[model samples]
Target chain A: MKRRISLFGALREADARGYIEVDVPAHSTIAELREAVQHYAREHAPAISPGLIQRSAFASGDEILHNHRSVPEQGELAILPPVSGG
Target chain B: MTEIYTAVVDIAHGPLRPAEALEFVADPRFGGIATFIGRVRQHNLGRVVTGISYDLFDALALRTFQHIGERARQEVGGPMKLYIAHAKGDLRIGDFAVVVAAATPHRDEAFRACRLAIEAVKHEAPIWKQEHYIDGHSAWSEGCSLCEEHRAEEQRAAGLAATQAGDAHGHEH
Candidate 1:
């Protein structure tokens, strides 16, 4: 299945792309998805720091997901860094 | 005599209005209403900041606002109304960046809910701020860490100066 990973903040800076489509096995966990995203960033966007990827949070819809959590195959996977809104 | 819990969450491109936020939580039965408006300051840390640009993940941000409202209601243990509006895109100094309001039958809960809502919005919402400095540099700010760092540095410098002055007085004695 192809998962559309949406980047935000520093993650977007790392990806150098708004989003990227990656193929993963069914029922892929967020940990696996994050690794895939990192790999994509490493390959595509060299300017993105490893520190940024390490700090990023993965979310499905509005809920921030733990690495162990199962990511829904549907919908965009948001890359959320430390939020600074007032 | 109003809804048990009324929530209004918006991620807008234009300026957020405090009046609209206040109106959302207005109810005849509520005895107290508390509202907080966050404006873009002309300076941050030691840097002269001209403006800021807010970027938000709208769908997720709204979801976070709703969750915050629910959490506030549960914690307050009362009927309440919550209104939150956040601005996106470019904002000049003194522009309203965000507005949070809470209305309840009592002052305590109203204050608690309002505080919680704004804090949660700052920590939880998927919004990023890029501060434009007068030095012609712009960078993303994380929880205003840059400002915090500057403050810390100033405090450290002041402490060192005070210690040095005390040492000079001791020598004179």
Candidate 2:
């Protein structure tokens, strides 16, 4: 399945739209999605690191998803890097 | 009679208005009001910061603010009003990035609630800050250690759970 993940913070520098789209296996869990994204980053986005992707959290709508949770089939989700708001 | 205000939370794209926050928290019956404004500074980590751009997960950020307000009110144990807002886009040095206001019947509760509100926003909100430097370079600010702390705590908990399960299943050499 193809998923578009919105990016923020330092991750925004990876792409002009502040987001990236990657293909994942059907019914992929967040942990699997993280691996896919890390692979994508390595090949395409030098600014982002696999370690950062490992630490980043995925959010579906307003709720943050745990690693074991499955990615939804519809709509876009966000990839939240460690926050720095004041 | 005007309806009593409990909490007002927003993620604004334009400039944040401190005056509006003050006005929202104002009440004749309340004896004290406290406000905290966080502004973009010119210097950070010994580097000159020309400006900053703030990003947010809007829905989650607003929900976090409301939870902070409710928690503050519960902990302070008083009639309280809160106003919280954070900027969402590019801002120059000296521009306000966030504002928190609280009003309570007593000075102590007002102060405590205001402090709690701001601190919670700083730690819990899903917002990010990217600072632009004078050398035509930019970097995201090093965020608070809360995320790392949370991860550490989770690891500890998982370790404990695994140990307990091992104990139940009999130790393996």
Candidate 3:
């Protein structure tokens, strides 16, 4: 399954469209999604480090998802990097 | 008709108005009002910062701001009004990036609420800032260290859990 994930902060620099598409198995958990995203980054976004992806949290709408939680079947989710806003 | 105001939170795409925040928090019943403004400075870590771009997850950011306001009000425990606004998009040096204001019956509560709101917004809000330098390069500013701390804590807990499971398995064998 293909999921479109919104990118923010430094992750935005990775793709000009400000988002990325990752291929994951259906009903993949957040941990699996993160691995797919990391794989995509490694191949396409060399500037973004695996550590950064590892530290980032995934969000569906306004809620942050735990690693154990499954990704929603529909809708684009966001990848939140370590926040710096004051 | 008189207006009842408790909290005003927004992810502003344009410049943030501190005056508007002051107006929102203004009330005859409140004796003190505290305001905090965060601006983009010219230099950071010995590098000259020309500008900054702020990216935000609008829905989550606003939700977090509301949570911060409610928490501040409860923590301070008084009739209070709070205002929080954070900039979204490009900003030059000296531009306001965030504004937080709190009004309370007493000075201490007002100050405390204001401080609490700003701190929460800095650490909790789903917002990111990329600092553009004079050398035509830009990098995301490292804002909250809490994320790293939380990650470390999670790793530690997982390690402990794995070790405990290993011990149990060894005993069973």
Question: In TM-score terms, which candidate is top?
Answer: 3
iRMSD per prediction, in order: 8.2, 6.7, 7.3
How would you encode candidate 3's per-residue C-alpha lDDT over A1-86 as one tens digit per residue? 88899998988977999999988988899989988998899899999988888778898766778788899889759888878877
- Tell me how far candidate 1 lies from the true structure as C-alpha RMSD in angstroms: 8.8
Which of the two candidates, 1 or 2, achieves a greater DockQ against the reference? Answer: 2
Those runs of model 2 whose alpha carbons end farther than 4 Å from true positions after fitting are: B1-13, B145-150, B153-173
TM-score of chain A of 2: 0.94
- CA lDDT, candidate 1, residue B161: 56
Candidate number with the higher TM-score (2 or 3)? 3
Choose the strongest candidate by lDDT.
3
Per-residue CA lDDT of model 1 for A8-82, tens digit only, reads 665567545677777778888877877887787789787877656655677777577877788787777777765
For candidate 1, the iRMS in Å is 8.2
For all candidates in order, state the fraction of native interface contacts they contain.
Answer: 0.52, 0.54, 0.72
lDDT of 2 by residue, B1-173 (tens): 32123222333435788998889888887889989999999998788999988888787777778778889979788688888888888888898888888888888998999888887787667888888999999887655322343456544655755566642111110
For model 3 chain B, give the 10-residue run with minimal summed lDDT.
B1-10
Q: Which docking class does model 1 fall in?
A: acceptable
Instruction: Report every candidate's CA lDDT.
Output: 0.73, 0.77, 0.79
Q: Of 2 and 3, which scores higher on DockQ?
A: 3
